[model samples]
Target: MTTLITGATGKTGQRVAHRLQTLDHDVRGVTRHSTPRFDWHDRTTWAGAVDGCESAYLTFQPDLGLPGADEIIGAFAAQAVAAGCTRLVLLSGRGEDGAQRAEQAMTASGAEWTILRSAFFMQNFTEGAFADELAAGSLTMVEHTVAEPFVDADDIAEVAVATLLDKGYVGRVLELTGPQLLTFEEAARAVGGPGVAYLSMPTEDYITVLTEAGLPAADAAGLAYLFEEVLDGRNAYVTQDVETVLGRAARSIDGLAGGEQS
Candidate 1:
């Protein structure tokens, strides 16, 4: 039986799919562009994507933090279970109400489920939203003293693969994070070396900067809210869940930078 991977082209999804393939597991990677297109907005395509798959890794697009994301996730989980998928793993964010709701929805689906409640990804600097600024030798953000225990995408993927294949991890919610916390300025230095500049702006100013750079106004506001509110010291601590699952320490931003900059 094949394992289905939704959002297969995304950061975590792509890593999960590649690792599963490396293990010689049969994987059906689906996106809005795949043979059996799987779109979060289109219910008709879901059944086809879940069909014949014994397990699935679900990554909700835009974000699971959006309103009504739980309903969509709940529906997808139900469909996956009804189609004979016994295992479901969901990628989720920490300390967000919407994410918790989505997790609850997956748990209620009656499938053996594992929720990977992850911290801010270290890859955001290397491959995601902050990549361009970091590459240009400067990074800017809302001014704050809050620190994040950013986890590696590869570590999350390893844990996902473990839970998918091992029934031992069934019904678990793994809180994944790096071994240490770092402020955004510290993170910028780690990724771009000591010469890299870190610029701090007020939350509103940061949102304005984002909007001026072509991000939608609503999207910019959401990002500002995330940095100014959600990330405000609430997630400063580290967790050993990655070490517990992977049998190794979670990769730190400095470690990731070392490897990437080598």
Candidate 2:
């Protein structure tokens, strides 16, 4: 079956695309840089990406927690339905209002949808927004000892591909997480050597650093709130959805850290 993967070059999307392609599935990857670009802000670009695909893995750029994301995702889901796409898999975050709204939109869309509400990714230290800071030998965040069950992106991609190919997970909102909970210091120690420091800074101070590093004000504030508010002992528990969907234990952060690539 033909499948379109939006944000095709991203951490999770790239893994999903590769897994699908290895299985001999016809895959089309769309990015803002693609020939028929799939810019989420441009409606005209949406149709071109959806046209010829029977299934799609949709990952919103920046994040689903951004303002107006609900409306944007809803519009794109409608377009995918009109283009004859039958199955949709949405990547979303847990405990965010906007993500909940976006999930609602996907549910109402005509296509059969699966919502993957994920915890913080372990790959964040190696390949994501936190990589640069970790490489610089220091990562800063708000000083909360609340631990999170950071899941692996590989697990997420596997689940997404499964959702697309299997009918069992349709209409299910899967909460994915790793097998254990870890604090930022513990996580840093897992990824980086002892020399790499995990500094717990004040929320406002961290926001200042983010803005100084060139993130927009809205984004910086959102991140500060995410680290300070959402992470306040809320998502400390682990889930078995990964095991349920993949029929195996969820990959642990320790396993990911000891691998060739972090």
Model 2, runs deviating above 4 Å:
260-262
Best by TM-score: 2
The residue pairs found clashing in candidate 1 are: none
Candidate 1 backbone clash number: 0
RMSD list, candidates in order: 1.9, 1.5
162: Cα error in model 2, Å = 0.8
Superposed Cα deviation of residue 230, candidate 2 (Å): 2.0
Runs off by more than 4 Å, candidate 1: 260-262
Q: TM-scores, in order shown?
A: 0.94, 0.96
Task: Put down candidate 1 lDDT per residue, 25-93, tens digits, no spaces.
Answer: 999999999999999989999989999999999999777876778999999899889999869999999
- The digit string of per-residue lDDT tens for model 2 on 26-110 reads 9999999997799988998988888889999999978888788899999889888988997999999988877899989877888
Candidate 2 clashes between residue pairs 3 or more apart in a chain or in different chains: none
